[model samples]
Target: MSPLPRFGRIADGPPAPAGGGESFATLLAAGGARVERIASLAQADPPGAWYDQPGDEFVLLLQGAARLGFAGGEERALAPGDWVVIPAGCRHRVAWTDPARETLWLAVHLPPIAGRGAIADQ
Candidate 1:
């Protein structure tokens, strides 16, 4: 037996953030892996704030544009169709996002692999 199919649109639910914030929608979850849709509108992390996750994150820019900043001072600009895999323990933060329009992102959180701190190319 298998689970039933699930369908959804990233923009189907939740309006853009009012004022300044981000909206998250969980699309799937199995075991320790999860998929999410993140909608951002004129939102960014507070100064000096960084996200250091215990697991790896694969993110794709679905719509709009944004920039990511790393703890080492490297910044990467993202546009539609752009994707990046952030390894566990990598300090990062959202530096900028399209403020005039909604910025949509598809993020996949991968279960942490013991003894590995980075993701290798397949």
Candidate 2:
């Protein structure tokens, strides 16, 4: 058959896993970058928790809405078509997500870009 159709709906997936823990599925990986589909069902970082990733991450909010809190004490709200980049070594957390709807996200992870600053800082 021809190359597998690289196609599917972003929101296509079984209902968010029970317990509402955010679910992440990698869709592609190549060289030094990868893509994923993340679904968050009314979830937020655990009490006082944060993420300190080893690589940079760029995420686009495709459905519902979300709030991202950075270690620098700033919280950014994201809506459909909105995107943000978290530079490697940056500390951040999911502050909130629309609990009444399914929050769908397309996320890309890549090796740190030399001398790049957190997109939220600009």
lDDT of each: 0.90, 0.83
Candidate 1 structure quality by residue, lDDT tens digits, 33-106: 99999999887898799999989999999999999999989999999999999999999999989899999999
What tens digits encode model 2's per-residue C-alpha lDDT throughout 18-79? 66758888888988889989988788987569888878899999988999998878999999
> Which segments of candidate 1 are over 4 A away from where they belong?
none
How many angstroms is residue 75 displaced in model 1 relative to the true structure, after the best TM-score fit? Answer: 1.0
Instruction: Flag clash pairs in model 2.
Output: none
Q: Candidate 2 — worst ten consecutive residues by lDDT sum?
A: 112-121
What's the TM-score of every candidate structure? 0.93, 0.83
Q: lDDT of model 2 at residue 106?
A: 90
Best by lDDT: 1
